[model samples]
Target: MDSIQMFLANCNLSVSQAMRKIDSNSHGILFLVDDNNLLVGCVTDGDIRRYLLSGGGMSDVVARASNQKPKVARSLAEAIKLYHNRDYVVIPIINNQGIVIDMYMGEGVKDKKYSPLHLPVVINAGGKGTRLDPFTRVLPKPLIPVGDLPIIELIMQEYQSYSCDEFHIIVNYKRELMKAYFADNEANYNITWYDEEKPLGTGGGLSLLRGKLKSTFFFANCDALLTANYESMLKFHKDNGNVITMICAYKNINIPYGVVEMGENGVITDMKEKPLISFLTNTGIYIVEPEVIDDIGDEEAIGFPDIIEREKQKGKKVAVFPVSENDWMDMGQLPELEKMRKKLFGE
Candidate 1:
């Protein structure tokens, strides 16, 4: 099979099977073809998401979720024109028979337009980072190098892409190094540094700015880099009137090999060759309102999840914004450092 073949899916395939094709393409799109290899429809990344959110099952045929009418070009000239003139990132070139022959995937397209959010960002950089002990012994985890730039810098740059510049960083362990590193950097970031007098947990340090923040803000861990759109997250928070919106990603766990389920007396009940299970996990990034700060007791040590749970118990609106698994880069573990580097630089 050729490179473009990865982007083609059978119309009869299950939604999960089509999802695997979409993942392989890495462009969040699939061209659906019938048995005769003629394009029947298209499924973009958002299509499956909508299908799932609308109570559609993953085991159903993808034909049920695909757009029956998809944009296609019958000639090279038409394909180029469509690629440049519209927001569509990928366009399929098809012959008179509607068989896909070529593709215009990248380049010559307009840059992604992002509206200014102007939200404040708070980074919790205070932990001792015992997870990365040896490295944390040498340098703060926030300063740990993912590539040429430090992890903290990468986190800030992603937010900067959405026009969020104001930052509040809470620091404790090796704080002087964290402050000095940013102070001497030429980027000249506008930052307000908060010191934890004692070891305050993730949500505890946020209390330092209890009365200062007047609007919604972005809160994140220093080690997590999210490539998803920040503007969409903010819109969801405000549109749903949620006091807190936790950004999460679906993690797909694939179990290979035939597995059997047994009943009493070890009788075989059922079996499957392989299974793919997906679970949504927190990415440690959040859209938060200022009022949440006042809810935290000053200098109390509590993880952010616990704090959010407390607010939920009080009947506050806390929602979740889901993104795909590949959108998040976690630098907390030692093994993930190289993975994150390769992801950002494609080394």
Candidate 2:
């Protein structure tokens, strides 16, 4: 029996899907998928690198590697040698007719836990934050004190909990101060800086970061806060290969008075009192692919929603991941910040 069959119970992925797993992992050589407890196909590092070199997009299927024969090993030493020479991280022990009996993974597989890849988060912190009133007169929105810690740090900590450390923070106003703050209190993480000489509209600031960032990185309005599991979200993004993914929260509004729905013939067909309406408002968070950022115009203040519309015109894949109403928090307004403080630390 091969190790691939064992992983079938663990990963719950098809052979075709398992093969692509090597792309994200550096040490892994190949991934194995099973079909009804039977060996199906294998994926190798070479297969993924070739696909990228060919300019094959993320949406392109990696089904080609499924036809190749997997390297077999009888003992652990033989498997280790095969893994080292061929650079295959996982070797499946199989019998005739491609039946997976057992599987083996490289070292650290037992120690390191698996974290899901969903979306990379990019936080835009460049704005002057005129909406924040007196706070903007002194500190940047990211630097504003939420409770005991700065708001940006809290935001980063939230994403960090999900093992997302790849961050890109757009800086314009007080760029020096922001950089200094981060440098002084360095958190062992990777954060690429995007500086704007002049004010660039929310969408325009991202134009400079097109190629420097990952193919898909989430964009968040610095001042906004929300509670959600990033691991699950990124898994959804990869599974769908979405070009743009929005994290939305539902907002409910109550009508104070009765409302009537009238027909064209001046007849009131329906009447409801104090109706509670629900809407999926933008939560100021987005998971955007690199190709989408390429369309951003240079040195202008363009909004991301406009870019989304453009992608839609071109028939690109744009999606939304919704969160519960209580799980989301907006710090745009002063009162909202107070409410968030209480929610975060309790009154």
Candidate 2, which segments miss by more than 4 Å at Cα? 1-120, 186-189, 263-266
Off by over 4 Å in 1: 14-17, 57-60, 106-110
For TM-score, the strongest prediction is 1
- In candidate 2, what are the lDDT values of residues 240-276, reduced to their tens digit? 8888888776455668989999999999999999765
- How much lDDT does each candidate structure score? 0.88, 0.68
Alpha-carbon deviation at 239 in model 1, angstroms: 1.8
Would you estimate the TM-scores of all the predictions? 0.93, 0.64
What is candidate 1's lDDT per residue for 25-92, written digit by digit as tens? 77788999999999999997578766876777767899999999999988878888997788776788
Residue-pair clashes per candidate: 0, 16
